[model samples]
Target: MSQKQKILIAIAGPTAIGKTALAIEVARYFNTEIISADSRQFFKEMSIGTAKPNPQELAQAKHHFIDSHSIKDDFSVGNFEKQAIACLGKIFENHDVTVMVGGSGLYVNAVLYGFDELPKASDALRAQLNERLKTEGIELLQEELKNLDPDYYAEVDVYNPQRIIRALEVCLSTGKTFSSFRNKQHKERDFDIILIGLNTDRELLYSRINQRVDLMIKDGLVEEVRALQAYQHLNALKTVGYSEIFRHLNKEWTLSEAIEKLKQNTRNFAKRQITWFKKNEGIIWFEPTETQQIIDFIKEKLITTTK
Candidate 1:
């Protein structure tokens, strides 16, 4: 393979669409290591709930960022972008191509197109705003956002209190309009990124999500979450499978009802994932089964980019 330029082969898709299997295959094809972009899979304690790769899959390829952190640690996407870039710099020294795969679009984007440094707000400020939202109604918040950051107000969903508050959070905290933080210039990187998305029919995608949820339950997902009940309040534990199981353990629902909710929530999450990835027009889409075709496509892209 030509080392004229480096390429990161990113395999992205909704949950259970075979991104891990395809990434392993591509890594083998290029004799390259894999970098996980899955945010949930970073924690060592999160296994079945995150659908992390099995021992066999890990053995197939040298992977990075899997089981790399503790759930107790506060690992933000900004931290990930820094560490992942440093990791890629080391990988690029030996190989021209590296495979990065995951369904977490935000984390993937953090590495692909680094985010601008937006200032964080105080918890007290957030609590104050949320309390205002409770007493004053969304209209007050909407009006506040419209007056505070008209540009973001025009673009954001005015009805969404969360969106309005997020904008207002930046505005009120920084004394700058949230729109100023919106369009960040893409970070300059030495390596190139070629994004490949796994495409599936909507019904098939939902079915796959449901099946994966079932398999997680069968693989002792509840036991795993139960063991981590002490840490259930952590943001990392607030994901689909674990969250539903936590509620069930709290006697909010029966086991079967929890499973049903888990399945439905996962399907909805997959829908949202698809919607998030679709916004990036650069992604080349394919069925997960099209391994050979995907490989060929990557080879062609690598050649074209090198020239």
Candidate 2:
């Protein structure tokens, strides 16, 4: 008999789309483990704001990469790609199928289709970009990226200085659009990937995003931020829930205003996630509540492949 291909079921969607719950259900059905590709959930210090899986959910399925790194660790997407691949090697040992879940499109893409070999940035170049950010302001860098790589700018988190600077470094060093280098040639993975994307009406999604933020706040998102104030300068903390609250703690905005901004920013982030996931035609879209249907679809695929 031919060796059965190891299947990696990628459960992906926007924030507040119930990815974790659905991933647990699917992983349970497969009797396998899950690998989290959510960049925010990787840090041990970012539970409340990142909407990390509660202990009960984590207990339902074996999960990797959740709180696997400290906030102080310099974890990059490149590092994640390598670590996730290594984790999968171990997972495929006992199970024929494993699930990968997250809202971070870049991290998911890194595991499914390996990243392209882009030009590396030198220390001097990074320092120059950082200085530009310090003096010229983010608007200037945003405009530069918009002009150079409008496609990436459209999908990326514009408020993220690290992403913006990385794009600019590539644009300046290689004189090429950052988006142009993506998906150039995918590295071969030993496993077959099945992408399942969850989506709903825009209004419903926004509503969920707002509600999730409120719950996070009620769950002491402010206290979480306050606890990690010393690490506020960390790149991991430069996220939606934390950043808005940091501004509030800085007395730049009223607490109420910060809460509203957090909701608005989260909604915007969800929209960007949708835009990024929609570009991948390989994904099979479903409503977030379609648990049985998703399982049946996966089973059908398995049957066809096995035969």
Candidate 3:
């Protein structure tokens, strides 16, 4: 599909690196819409924790898949790949290029390269992994995955238990590394892909992540999490910010401690996201301030690809 006239301009990077703003700018430039690949932002129940776009951002350019589902719904990466392809088809009907932005490596890759049908684990196996999560903490499973499938570990959001548990389930059930089942062959789609990545120095990136977490708390992240206490056991609430606050609510930690943990965990998540996107050599990196340069690069790619 490299020669295809249609294009999917994928903007990828660590959290709080300005992918959303860049994608909106690109989409507005092309008079095209954005197809979000952010796995968390899809749920309506998630807001401050996910750093979803503000109303102004959504108004700037039409977006798809943001707040498009409920936390109760089971949306798999494969489901996202299938739905995103269908959404892209509609976007390509009017424009030659559309933008997809996110920090999620798995969902992004699932869209670009077809997802592999990994062998499923039995209910008992999944329960056992969840039990481990309850007793041993996510760190143990993270270490196990690191040893078993270091490739996946380097890229995966290690804090996401659903992902970690699923990978381990496959590893334990099949006696094979979970990464072994990934798609080595690229999937052909109707559109060409132009991958873009955003980043900054580690210090600045971590600072931004810390500040973002601080802002989330200021913006009522605790209130939001508290409202969803009954559903805290749900996988969507098992994420960094919410989980930290849940610990606070459960009297396991002070609010200040929870806030500090939230910042630290977010910084760690951003680091992993950088690792994941950096592995894709096709992505052209830029600072968040280099918006014009990115737009110019996109125009250049479009000309060359069309020719």
Candidate 4:
């Protein structure tokens, strides 16, 4: 008889979509563990802003990759893919299934389909791009990228200078659009993947995003950003909540304005996430409240796969 295939249930969706709760529930149902693919939550320094699992929720299930690295460390999607696969290997030793959850589509895809090997940017090129960012401003880089690779520009977080710079570096170095290198071929994985994407109405998701940002502020998000002020140059700190608050600290905007920008940026981020996940036809969509239905669907898939 063939051995039972170990399955990796990937819980994916936008910010404030309750992926963490659903992942924990699914892990508990399968008597398995969870691997978090949320790139923002991986750093130990980020907590309230990242919406990491609370003490009670974390204690309810075994979760790996949360607070697994220091923000000072140079972690990339490639690194995550390597580390997460190793994590899943250990997890699969004792269980037939493991749950992976996050809204970071690239990180999730890294585990599902390994990244294609691309040419590394030289230090000179990186320094040149950084210099250009310092002098020309982000707008120039954004416009250039849009002209060069409209496909990537459409989905990329335009607010993220690091991501924009990286894509530009690749485009400049290879004389090709950065999107051309993505998913050109797939890397095989040992386990089967089932993607469960949680979604709700657009207005409802926006409301949740706004409310979540408010909660983050009340929960001392400003203080958190203040603490990490020294590391603002780090790529990890360039994220949504921290970046907007950094602008406030820099006196570019009032605290109230910064908070508003935070909400707006978060909503924009969620929209991009939905766009990215929608491209993946394999994802089985459901509302966040339908936990039982998701579990049943998973079991049904497992039964069919086994048969």
Rank the models by lDDT, top first.
2, 4, 3, 1
lDDT tens readout by residue for model 1, 1-307: 4443789988998888999999999999999999999988999999998899999999999999999999999887789999998999899889999999998776788888886777788999889988897799667998988898775554443433555676788999999998688437888777788999998999988888888888999999999999999997676786778878988999999999999988987887777678778878999999988999999999999889988
Q: Single out the weakest 10-residue window by summed lDDT for candidate 1.
A: 154-163
Model 1 off-target regions past 4 Å? 1-4, 127-168, 171-180
- In the range 1-307, model 2's lDDT, one tens digit per residue, is 1224888999999999999999999999989999999998999989999999999999999999999999899999999999999999988888899999999999999999996777898999999999998899777999999999999998898777889999999999998999988989998998888899999999999999888888998999999999998888777888789989999999999999999999998888889899999999999999998999999999998877657
Supply the TM-score for candidate 2.
0.97
How many residue pairs clash in all the candidates, one count each?
Answer: 0, 0, 0, 0
Total backbone clashes of candidate 1, pairs 3 or more residues apart or in separate chains: 0
What global local distance difference test value does model 2 have? 0.91
Structural similarity to truth (TM-score) of each candidate: 0.85, 0.97, 0.96, 0.97
Q: Which ten residues in a row have the lowest lDDT in candidate 3?
A: 1-10
Stretches off by above 4 angstroms in model 2 are 1-4
Candidate 3 has a TM-score of 0.96
Candidate 3 structure lDDT: 0.90
Evaluated at residue 245, the lDDT of candidate 2 is 96
